[model samples]
Target: MEASKVIHAIYTDDDVLMSAVKTVKAEKYHIEEIYTPFPVHGLDKAMGLAPTRLAITAFLYGCVGITVATVMMNFIMIQDWPQDIGGKPSFSYLENMPAFVPIMFELTVFFAAHLMVITFYLRSRMWPFKKAENPDPRTTDDHFLMEIAVHNNEESLTNLLKNTGAVEINIVNKDEDAH
Candidate 1:
């Protein structure tokens, strides 16, 4: 298959980049990706991306953590070795739930946080010792890079980006394996 061509429009300021994104979308152009030095508020809305569902996954992870804590505490304290502390020889999980409240809360938080991090890393295709996929290193410091897929309308796209205050514009054939 032929390699796809993309236009990289570099902007110094994020405000200009935001305006340019709106204009590009208004023109019915497909934006491949955008890299910014810092988080740009409402950029996802401008790009028309759906909201992330990580929060739901985190809730599920927290639930699992709670279940595991409850089961483990019941088996270890009530079933395995029932201790008679404070004149209470009750071998019941319900009776000892109050003592396990802190453990349950801590495990829930720990599972949600750690699992969310792992999920994000896997979903983003970021693994240990993986090479960076950034097209320009300047984007990490002070520049914002906007990548737009070219569909044989390079001139018009270039003109539109130039008018939208792009500091530099470059057209290059995108590598299929790079993504």
Candidate 2:
């Protein structure tokens, strides 16, 4: 795995952070990550991140879930158990479908929710019982931070960050405490 030499910079407000991000992008600097206490509007565009396809993935998975539930319910209730046990008509599958709808709906929801959760975890590089990788504890509180990893040049990077209106800057190592 490639290691990053990160410079952690803190800003007081989201607007200031947004300005810094815009300046960094305009200068063509590769930003590793930005940490904020809450969602910052237009931050994704400033970072030049591609739009997420999670909604599309979720929709496709939900369709698969519905299809599976429909097929399974039809096979078991119509083909396998042909007897009209609960005063249901045995000849018509569509007519009796309303009665089997609850189970089918429940199964579809179950499959879709589980599959979507798994997809999210895998895409975010998170797994069961995995350790969290939060760099600064203050970021979760009131601070907004930006991290940039430079390639063999520190002075120019620092100057660029200062010009971008960073309030405070610190060099961070991977093993150090987050605070």
Candidate 3:
């Protein structure tokens, strides 16, 4: 496959980056991605990105955790080896639910957190020992980088990005075979 050229517009401040994103969107240029030192409020809205479904996934994971905890506790306390403690016989899970509340809560949070992290990693195409895809290291520290595909309008795009307060701009040719 042929290589494609892309523009990397680097901004020092997130506010400038956010405004640039709005301007770029208004001009109908497709923004490939944006990198930032930290989370920028409203950046996703400015970039017109779809709302995330991670919250829904987290809720489902929490429900699964709760169910697992309930079933495991029921089997252990009621069916497998029933023990009488505090004068309360472990004969039914429903009656002993109050005692298992802390365990249930912990497992729910644990599943939600761990599963969400794994989901995020997989969704982002990240894994252990994978090479970093960041174009610039400064973006991880103090800069914001916006990537726009160069669609035979380099001069116009460069001018627009400059006007939008880009501190540095670079054109990179990405080869499909480079990876």
Candidate 4:
């Protein structure tokens, strides 16, 4: 990709960052990214991001997990190794279904939580050992950073960022980072 000028606006507090984001959006500027030390609730809504589909994926994974658990349990208990425990015959899957409820529930939650996290990381392009995309290290400590591409309106954008409670502003050339 060709190099371009990008603006990095830094804020010390998340509340100030939220207000600044609102001000920037009101001026019709596109925020490329925002780095936060921790999760900022409602920041995605303020940025006008669409709702994530991770929950849908989690539900599907849970269904798969429960189905697998049921099939595995049925195969082991009823089909492969049929045994009588305490003189109670374990032959009918329907009759012994209650015994497998805990396994089903645990597997459901396990699949939903683990697979959803993997899905989120994969969908977000945050695979293992990738180069860090964070522009400023301070953002990981106690600050927030907002990145905006400067498309020939550097002066105006800088002025706007300055007014939006930015603690520090830096102009970065994307060309230099490439090397």
TM-score of each: 0.95, 0.81, 0.95, 0.95
Whole-structure CA lDDT of model 4: 0.91
What's model 2's overall lDDT?
0.83
Q: lDDT tens string, model 1, 1-44? A: 76899999999998899999999999999999999989999999
Query: CA lDDT, every prediction?
Result: 0.94, 0.83, 0.93, 0.91
Give lDDT tens digits, candidate 4, residues 33-147.
9999999999999999999888899999999999989999999999999888867678699988887899999999999999999998898899989999888899889999999
Please write out the lDDT profile of model 2 over residues 1-179, one tens digit for every residue.
54546788888889989999998888888889999999999999989999989888877877888788888878887888877787878776687888878877787778778898999999999998987676778888988999888677678888888887888888766444442
* Backbone clash count for every predicted candidate, in the order shown: 0, 0, 0, 0
Task: State residue 78's C-alpha deviation in candidate 4, in Å.
Answer: 0.4
lDDT string for model 3 (81-173, tens) is: 999988986868988999999999999999999999999999999999998988889989999999999988999999999999999999998
What C-alpha lDDT does candidate 1 achieve relative to the native structure?
A: 0.94
- Any idea what lDDT model 3 has? 0.93
lDDT of 1 at 9: 97
Candidate 3 TM-score over all chains jointly: 0.95
Q: Deviation in angstroms for 16 in model 4? A: 1.1
Name the runs in model 3 displaced over 4 angstroms: 176-179
Off by over 4 Å in 4: none
The regions of model 1 sitting more than 4 angstroms off are 176-179
